[model samples]
Target: MELDDLDWKILALLQEDGRMTFTELAKRVSLSAPATTERVRRLEAAGVITGYSATVDPQRVGLPIESIVRVRVRSLDTPRFRTNVLVLPQILGADHVTGDDCWLLRVVCRSMVELEQLVEEAQRYGDTTTSLVFSSHVRNRPVDISIFVGIVSR
Candidate 1:
């Protein structure tokens, strides 16, 4: 799992274009095709590269609305509310956090009505606050090789 600068460069490139062929990636990073392929394989083997996927515009795909819902569970004691949180399909990300709320969710909905419905359904478990995210400054970012190597060194 020890990755050098080259590995981080490959990862950063792949994060932007997962479908890049080994030849193309090799050209970008000045590695041989086999070397590029092997590096990608190693990253995959070490679980650094989990999988490849396409980045689609949600609005173009018909789901235009993107929002985050903050949930405050009444009974934060047990597993019942936790189960409910995972079963919701519109939810993209969910976290049990350290602040005031019990959970925060990143959700996408087709319309305001649908978003309202989802929030209402979520009320069975807790009170929810819906906020429409106008624009995302950064979605995901590449990891620093320095940080990765430091953590791996330990």
Candidate 2:
């Protein structure tokens, strides 16, 4: 979609706080509440706004250990690995990337034993390398629109 300045502003504000009401959003964007609602709906219809979700701290949820598991799966086992990985609750997210590793997974576990077991399960497919996350400098920062300012038409 060709988003204008107002649309970008709405996106920025929504990304900051998805729960913001249309009335407040309209006030911020200098538009009527109905207009703000219409724009938001249009953005949603166009698939620009996918969905809203809550950010939960793993530690508070009894899952403190965070690890990045890099798996280099054998060519024949890729499909099976992908299907099985989703069933593992410890895996928070996975990315199929380019490089020596076929899959990069973000996992959280209650204890080291669980993490070890997870790694061992992955090793059944192929080589595995796991690293515990000490700290995350940027967990889930809002997208910086400035980088796409010139690239995307206003």
Candidate 3:
């Protein structure tokens, strides 16, 4: 999908507010509602627009403890570790990455004891290092289209 300026604008607007109506988006972009709708549809079909979701505050919702858990899994236990983590509700997100630690997880728990239990479970796979989050500078910022200007053009 070759995204022209209009498509980029639509993406920016939608990222800022996914709930924005097509008509409203059209007005801002100086295009007809149906045209804007079609462009959005194209973006979705091309896999650029994956899905819309509500951002929830973990602290407000009773899960106040947020931590980053890094796990260095034994090569033999990688599959088992992946399988086990899927059922853990405390794990908000996980990324398999390149480093001394094979897995980085965003975890939220109701209390420190719960986090300790989670760490113990993870230790079954391999060594674990966990750090509680004090603050977040950027939570969920919108994607800046300007960053991709040259690359997208090429």
Off by over 4 Å in 1: 74-78, 144-154
* Candidate 3: residue 147 lDDT (0-100): 85
Per-residue lDDT over 30-127 for candidate 3, one digit per residue giving the tens place of the 0 to 100 score: 99999999999999999999999999999999999999999999999998998886469999889899989999999999999999999999999999
| TM-score-better candidate, 1 vs 2 | 2
Highest lDDT, which number? 3
Q: All candidates' lDDT scores?
A: 0.81, 0.90, 0.91
Window of ten residues with lowest summed lDDT in model 1: 145-154
Better of 1 and 2 by lDDT: 2
Residue-level error in angstroms, candidate 3, position 108: 0.5
Could you give candidate 1's per-residue lDDT for residues 75-149 as a string of tens digits?
Answer: 653377667655777787888887678789899889999999888877877778888999999885655444654
What's each prediction's clash count? Answer: 0, 0, 0
* Candidate with better TM-score, 1 vs 3: 3
Order of the predicted models by lDDT, top scorer first: 3, 2, 1
Q: Rank candidates, TM-score, best first.
A: 3, 2, 1
